[model samples]
Target: MNEFLLIFRRDFTTAADQPSAESLQQHYRAWKEWFENLAAQDRLVGPTKRWDGAGKVVRNAKDVTDGPYADIKESIGGMLIIKANDYDEAAEVAKDCPIFAFGGNVEIRKALS
Candidate 1:
């Protein structure tokens, strides 16, 4: 089995506007359930949701302090590191991504060993 890094990218502002607090709680619950199922099946390496304010891109040796970059239209929301049999299996795992409900995108990349 090969392990792939599932990078979840979404328009932060768009997803933020789609759900109320209660709806968001439902989504969180669903997200947790999905992760738990994956864990039970031994398919997840780990899942991670990053803080939006932690982005930093350094160019050359100079520390350019622009910002954390969450203001961008296509900021990376979070990621899942999953162990799967193949890319097809990985795609199936990503099918339940919460961002998809908001028309967001998920990118799956094969990790270099």
Candidate 2:
């Protein structure tokens, strides 16, 4: 199986853009269930951890900056590593991601060995 990196992207730059607490809880549960299913199938290489919206960008030496990704409508929310036969398989796996319910998307890329 080939390893693929699934990049989860979403928008949470402003309070108005944030979901309600109830919705957030629902999404969290969906994520947990989805991950558990993947794990059970031995498809998850690493579910990894969620990314914080509050962060910084390091361009180069002495060129770091904050990155709520203020310039973009959406920013990376988290990432997961999974095993798949190919890009088509990886995409099929990502199609059920909880991100889509919230108008978010996943970017699947083959991990270079």
TM-score to true structure, per model: 0.80, 0.90
lDDT of 1 by residue, 1-113 (tens): 78899887666565445678887798788778888888898988755565463567666878665555634776676788888888999999899877787567889987777
Q: Runs in model 1 with CA error above 4 Å?
A: 14-18, 47-50, 67-72
Global lDDT of each candidate: 0.76, 0.89
Candidate 2 accuracy as lDDT: 0.89
Q: What TM-score quantifies how close candidate 1 is to the native fold?
A: 0.80
Q: Candidate 1: what lDDT?
A: 0.76
Off by over 4 Å in 2: none
Clashes of 1: 0
The deviation in Å at residue 110 for candidate 1 is 1.0
The digit string of per-residue lDDT tens for model 2 on 6-102 reads 9999876578777899999999999999999899889999546988878877766777788856578889999999999999999999999999988
